[model samples]
Target: MSRFSFNQITAKLWDLPDLVAGCVEAGVGQVALWREPVTEYGLERSAALVRDAGLSVTTLCRSGFFQAPDWFDDNRRAIDEAAALDTKVLVLVSGGLPAGSKDLAGARQHVADAIAELVPHAAAAGVTLAIEPLHPMYAADRCVISTWDQAMAIAEQHPVGQVGVTVDTYHLWWDDTVLDRIARAGERIAIYQLADWVTPLPQGVLTGRGLPGDGCIDMAAFHAAVEKAGYTGPIEVEVMNAELWERPGREILDATLTSYRKVV
Candidate 1:
């Protein structure tokens, strides 16, 4: 059976302990956390709590924002943290267009450069850099790595187990060639992320995602493709929406888990 987990980015505003507790209470067997939450409670403390709660730490939320000149230092810290917590994957959200820059290609180049710099650190820590490609709508300000093809290019260039792509359905459900890309990713797909895309897209880049079965994404087919791609990893539930947040945390958690087991 496939176990499901929560992506901390979806509940970005919750306190760290509360987030973990909610997931455990809602029967989530694992959690993918963000760095800020880890920083808040400290990695060791958070890891201990998660273990005490009988939950696995699936992966960390993200570690790559390759657009900054000082990104190296920050990435090293993230790697160190992941190592300490015994987490396996540090999901990398390749950064957006830098201010005043119209060059998407150039920004992508920066991502490549950063990955080149971080690979050794990540490899040393035995942590994988899971590159998460955001949707094209966020092409300008969220992530330049917008396709599995682009992510595969980076992974092949690096050729390290410490580097692969994180597949998020909300970011990629609309892709015409998704099934093919999923097949291509195969073993290199490090993380399988799920979230529903509702109509009337939200204004801000982050908070529009609906829960699985709450939108029109063919999630069952998506799961089939993921399984066919040889990825048996936990399917990470990552919903970022104002409506979900406004509802009780337990309710959202229950709904997300139910939808994944039933619809996805």
Candidate 2:
């Protein structure tokens, strides 16, 4: 329970202030925030609110879409935002191949190069760039970095704290060799996220994640690997189910805590 940090997306409709108060009430001391909601709430204001509440921000949602024309500026802004929130890790989602482009290899390489270029800025801000490998189902449309190996390869190119990989149970559960690889990752492992993998994924494969233990993933194996890697960071529950969002936020948080207790 001490390691648990409730990711805000687990209750997407929950207001920022309400979420902070809810976390304090629930005894959740850490959080993972998204960009849009934080932006809407105002950057410094959100930071001050969380700071005043004594909440530790584990990481920001994401900021890497290498194909975008303004990717550099956008990522720099994200770095600044993460700094403002007093969070050390800024999640990076390497976007899909450019429109109508069949060059998967090219797109991935571009992501690595883009991260390399952004390293100085991230380092200057004292933020670690945590590359997230979305599930392979999203490789064609959402993310090109779709495996632990891919994320690690890019991360290993930079200094440890300046760049690292995200360990999300929903994405890595299907890979048989991932456990061993993750155990060997050591400091290259950044934040660890939890979202059970459900079958018959919804369209676009974005919002159908199950809470921990709701789906068929062997979550215990993941925990063992992360522990073996010597990672003591926040364990964020980041499910994105539409049905869950329809429920009350407090109910959702309680359910998430229950699910987390069962898995951990």
Candidate 3:
């Protein structure tokens, strides 16, 4: 339980205060927050709420969409938010190709360049920018970084701790080469997120993730890889499913814990 962190998106409908209290009651000591909710609840207030409750903010959910015109400023603010929340890791989801553009190579290069520009700020803030590689299916409209190799290539360009990769099960399970890469990642692994991939992916394919044990992913294999990599950080349960979100918050948390225990 010490290593488990609940990502807020897993319980998307839960209000902030209730979610905090629920985690405390459930003996959940860590949580990964999303920017929208933190901003809506008032950042400082949310930080104090978690801090006062003795909860650790594992990582800020995300702050990279290089395709946006204001990405630089937005990501800078995200770094400040992570620092304010007293978290050391900020997840980066490199956005997909720009509208009317099909230059996959160019889009990927821009993500690397964007990270280089942000590394200094991230280092100064004592935060690690975790580049998350989404599944290849999302490459066109969600994330261009679609493999462990691509994420590592960009992260390796920067110093360890300043830049790293996010190993997410739902996104990487289909890649036969991912487990070995994750095993060799070492300190380059910034955060480890769990979500299984269910079949008949829904429209948009964004919220079709299953809990750890509900799909075809080999959670044990991923666990072994991260363990071999010496990652002793919090393991976050970050499932995103439309049906799951319809349940009550506490029920969601309970279900997530059950699913996690079966796999881990």
Candidate 4:
């Protein structure tokens, strides 16, 4: 059976305790947390609460942002936090293209460099860094790693068993070679995320995602690919639409679980 988790991104806060409580109440057993909340709660405290509540943390939300001046420092801190939480994966969102720098290739290189620099720290902490490929639309501001193939190439540059990639359906659904790359990733498949995409609107990326069955993507195919790759991690629901965020938490959680079982 496929287990489920919630990405703190869907909750929009850095409070791991609150998010953990919500997940426990919903009968979810795992979570992927963002850095800010963990920083606030202290990694040890966050880990304690999750374990106390009988929940396992799936992965740390992210550790890379190469465009930032403090790239090296950022990742080091992320490794420390992941280790403290006893999390097995540290998801990295490779930085976006810097302003006036249309050089996508160069931005990707920066990501490689950062990962190379941080590998030792990650290994020492016993944490695996998982690269996350955002959709091409966020190519300019969010992440340069935009495809499974690209992420796999980056993973190859790292030492075996130290780095991997996170496959989020909301970002990979449009890719023609998603399955091919997921299979190639094999054990490098560290985190598998599930969310939906709706029609775009004026506000931003938030408007584009819907609940699982509400969208048109072939979720079963996507899940099959990950399973074929031997990925047995929690299926994380990471919806962040304004509508869902605004509704009562229980309603959103109920709808999410229903969609997960029925559509995912």
TM-score of each: 0.94, 0.98, 0.99, 0.93
| Alpha-carbon shift of residue 143 in model 2 (angstroms) | 0.9
Query: Which tens-of-lDDT digit does each residue in 154-212 have in candidate 3?
Result: 99999899999999999999999899999999999999999998887788478889999
Model 4 whole-model lDDT (C-alpha atoms): 0.81
- As a TM-score, model 4 comes out at 0.93
* Candidate with the greatest lDDT versus the true structure: 3
Model 3, global lDDT? 0.95
lDDT of 1 by residue, 85-135 (tens): 778888888888888999989888889878988898899889998888888
Clash-forming residue pairs, model 1: none
Q: Considering only N, C-alpha and C atoms within 3 Å, which residue pairs clash in candidate 4?
A: 14-37, 198-208
Which residue pairs collide in model 3, if any?
Answer: none
Which parts of model 2 have CA positions greater than 4 angstroms off?
Answer: none
lDDT of each: 0.82, 0.94, 0.95, 0.81
Candidate with better TM-score, 3 vs 4:
3
Query: Where is model 3 more than 4 Å wrong at Cα?
Result: none
RMSD of each: 1.6, 0.9, 0.8, 1.9
